[model samples]
Target chain A: MIAPALHLDGSARYDGTPVFSDLSLRVPAGEWTCLLGPSGVGKSTILRLFAGADTGADFDGSFGADDGAPLDGRMALMAQDDLLLPWLDLRANVAIGARLRGEAPDLARAEATLARVGLAGMETRRPAELSGGQRQRVALARTLMEDRPIVLLDEPFSALDARTRSQMQDLTAETLAARTVLLVTHDPAEAARLGHHILIMGPNSVTPVAPPAGPIPRPVDAADVLGAQADLLRQLRGLPE
Target chain B: MSGWRAGILSALLGVAVWQAVVWATGLPRFILPGPGLVATTIWKSRALIAEHALITMTEVIAGLILGTVLGALSAVGLAASKWARTLVRPMLVFSQAIPVFALAPILTLWFGYGLGSKVVMALIIIYFPVTSSFFDALMRPNRDWIGLARVMGASPARIMWHIRIPAALPGLASGVRLAAVYAPIGAIIGEWVGASKGLGYLMLLANGRAKTDLMFAALIVLAVFTILIHAVVSRIATRLLERY
Candidate 1:
């Protein structure tokens, strides 16, 4: 039997302002879930909650991973910021999490992961030495070294040029394989392209975009998902009246 | 113009102005010896002045190493605890307020008339800058850099050894340069109080005997040691901190 990927129920807020409320959702193992919304609509907030950054905040929520354990090595998160250590060269940066885990052959795993993310042969360059696209690729490479069942990406391609961005999206699609991916992307086309299911977040709620016969998928029709997001927004806006 | 050429031209221009002033004013040699006379005296007494200068040099080097280690430890202690920081930092700040002259007497008394007192005085003088610079350096890792390290799952110890210490190298080197310059001067001050032998001792003897040229020559020796120490330290600093 497949374990549940993640479950978020109830509201999460910042300061006193409500961000997401009564927003219960579940992602199954090996499925990609895209959190789609306009800016300031709490898409990023949901990611943070799932990643366990929302500590001591004014919120009422139960976020439980499979097996009832607080999400630990079972999940890996990559923020929009690459956050590479300036002092370390590339290979060491990717190996950091493995080193933290005290795993042997961590450097070898790091190198393999680097190759998986299309960052082959650039292991010795410092963060400053790499281009922005290269840095993000390194970050994505680092994320893969975790080999966790779940992965979170927050606007990972927002900084890349279109060619690099498309390459990254392709790299992400290939590298992630069937991991439970919770992606926060503003690009409707991107959401339509890669998401297994689109969750439109707005009006402080995560409302699933009504699907076709099956889950939304890579090579999906952008117009279809964009129309779904628009309809969801309309439905949410109407509720305020 | 090339930097070296410009430096040479500036030096010549200054010396020419000095010679003109000396000739125009007819100032007594004891009061304001001309650069030429000083140079000649330095060349003539180079061996004697250098012997005493070597003692001063040895004192500076020893004091500098001892001071740096003590200062670095104090910085680590201050950074390690809030109580230490509160107690130690203000005391360090107020330390400068205590006249070095007043403190010199006490340091000499405690350590005594041996070269040990001079070394202690140098350590005291150099300690302030080293501690302050190290404090700034150590605290730097506690900022956004640490955030990156934590997010990458780097343990606190790894962060300190790899990122924090390496990052602080630049500031630490700068502090070392400042301390090196002060080390010799601080030793000389202790020597002035009452030393049997040193460049300072030689200067006192020369002054008492009305050996104006010898006094000027000793001053040149001190200057040479200062420049030599400064150059060596600066070179090491450049090599160590160029990465940062």
Candidate 2:
């Protein structure tokens, strides 16, 4: 399915204190949109809103797909924690969406997806047996199995080592190609490398930040990517560019 | 060392110490029979002791099964509904404030001196630990996993079954371990209050007749039985932890 563009314009408050008011942003369909900001700037709250998760705050305004339909049942999320059930094997974890919905899990499809994520012949291993990167690969496989048009990633690779992070970035980008992905992250380098359209969010407003002039999963040490990364870091630090 | 070897070595050491105490104290045969005399008494009265032990064992096993099932069900019920948690949780806590052992006489009075009262006694003793531990675990599932499951469009019942209950199995196993140790106490107390059979009744009968050797033998049997139950339950609990 072709991804639908997401448009959200809303205000949020917690315990009668406003988090952000008149915040508006659009995630273009079939591309990556990275929302980067300092911690506690409601970046994850925005993703939660799109994913239809409980935000633990009062949200006022309209947010929906530009196709004029609700985004429910059309989105999958990958959080900082892989969220794999420890008791389940890799195949079972990947196929949890079907089992959880009381449908017969397609075990063959789960095995195929595991192989797609490069976890072939390891489908029976538990999460505890896998390394951080391998576990995240299983998480990626689970997300792919959801088969949704929209994917929300909330710092999904933030816990990995630098080398593993880059490798996973490449894997996720390739596997989720052409899906509408809204990635919320604090790392400016990640935004510079992966975001097709970038938005820098502060306490009250969202500003468009132009990424490097290239496709996503951009080389880390490329001159333009480094320039964009430095510019993003300076912008985040509130310095004159 | 292997568990069995360690256990046997401990038992031998315990018997040696008991013999040393008997020799040092010079107590009368009726007052403190030596380990040798107790062992002989156990052999001589094995048939009689076995009869009473079978009764107590039956009571304990029945109570363990019933208590575990009831406690697990209550935990799930409490986890699934806010009303059950609000209305029943406080009642559960209040019930624990009343010492379960003190209720044995009342239970015997109500259910009579038959197996009914003994089973009820054991059930009451174990019900709280199992319910509370499992309920606490069910309420505290991994937030990220639950969030993911919710976004997957899983029904509430499916989430409870596939996620919450499985996540809480270790907690339930812990409760079962505690129940294994406590169940025997409840059954024995019930038998003490009033019962035609059971190891507790045998102990009291021997004591009344001044057959202290027989009394010591029965007490030892009861202790051994309780330890065996705990070992088995512990193994089961460890398997639950490892499997999950």
Candidate 3:
């Protein structure tokens, strides 16, 4: 399948205060694009717009695929919070998207996805029974089960410890390789590690920065990855570079 | 100790204290019958007490089922619509304001001292707690879960049934527990107003005839019945919560 490009142009205001204005960005097909910014710079808001999950935000925008089709039902979002339904077991939670759409949940496929996320034997466990990272992995399994062309992630791994985060990053980079992925995060190192192209979000605009020449997740100790990280830090801190 | 054992132990201790109180006060059986006297009355009048107890049980169980179903539906209606919530919430609160005991006589008069009045009374008593508790819970589903469901294209009705209802069940269970306790009170009050049957009427009749032991026996049976109802309702509620 040919991955569809996403273009979004909008100005958004929350409670009559403008969060961002005249923001425009393009997510190329089948590439991982990381949106790096400080907290509360509306990185997550942008993802919400793409996910069509924006609530109470007055937004004026047009979001469409490269072929000029609306993005509805074509994209799936993994929120900052894992957003696992507490009452559901791991397998049921992974199958919820299908169930919600009035389609019969494929329990077999759900179990397979859970196994892929390394939660093979814990299908019957509730979301509360798992640790934070495990819960996030279950959420990832849910997103993977969605299997949409566009995947929007909002700080999906912020709660994990360093080692687990690295493992998850590798899993995501490999699993979501062919999908158009837009990840929002405040961590420069995470952006350097996972993004094919990193976009530094400012007050009213997003600036694209060229990434190091390698497929992600790149090593944190790689020279080019470290150089990109330093450059991103400078950009975030507004220091002369 | 387990709950059942602890409950039985406490009940025995309570009877011992009661017998001691009767011994120290030197009260006659005509005034304050001792635990042994009450036990004897219970055994001798078992048939009479059981007949009345069964009538009261039927009223309470019928009312519990009807009130729970009606209250749960109302709570769902109120939670789903802004208009219903704005219009009906104050009415629900107002319904509770009219003293329930005062309505007992009116209900008995209207329903003609039959089972109808007692069932209606029990229903009215239980309705408010169930609706208010369940509605409060429905109104405040986990925000993150709701958001995720919305993003996944869940309709409002779907959210209400699949998400809100399941999430709010524990609250509904709590309301049912309160209703279970209150249901017996309603039925007894209605019976006291004008009933020829039920534990309440038996107590009143025994007191009029100076049968203090029989009255005490009926009261004890009623208390035990209430405790049993509460226990059963609690067990069912816990199971429902666990299943969902």
Q: Which candidate is the best by TM-score?
A: 2
| Tens-digit lDDT track of model 2 for A132-168 | 9999999999999999999999999999999999999
What TM-scores does chain A show, candidate by candidate in order?
Answer: 0.84, 0.97, 0.95
DockQ values, each candidate: 0.31, 0.78, 0.57
How much is B196 displaced in model 2, in angstroms? Answer: 0.9
Task: Using DockQ as the measure, name the better of candidate 1 and candidate 2.
Answer: 2
**What would the per-residue lDDT of candidate 1 be over residues B143-183, giving only the tens digit for each residue?**
53454445445666666666667777777788889998999
Give per-residue CA lDDT, model 3, range A36-152, as digits (tens): 999888888888777766456888887668888777777788876898888889999999987888889999999999999899989999998998888988999999998888888
- Computed on alpha carbons, the lDDT of every model, listed in order, comes to 0.76, 0.93, 0.90
Interface RMSD of each: 3.8, 1.1, 1.6
Worst 10 residues of 2 chain A by lDDT: A232-241
- Tell me each candidate's TM-score: 0.83, 0.96, 0.93
* Candidates 1 and 2, the one with greater TM-score: 2
The worst-scoring run of ten residues by lDDT in candidate 1 chain B lies at B142-151
Quote the positional error of residue B72 for candidate 2 in Å. 0.5
Ranked candidates, highest lDDT first: 2, 3, 1
Task: State which candidate has the highest lDDT.
Answer: 2
The residue ranges of model 1 lying beyond 4 angstroms of the native Cα positions read A1-4, A9-28, A37-64, A99-105, A210-241, B80-83, B142-145, B151-153, B242-244
Q: Give the alpha carbon lDDT tens digit for every residue of B108-221 in model 3.
A: 888888899999999999999999999999998887777678777788888887889998998899999999999999999999999999999999999999999999999999
Clashing pairs in 1: none
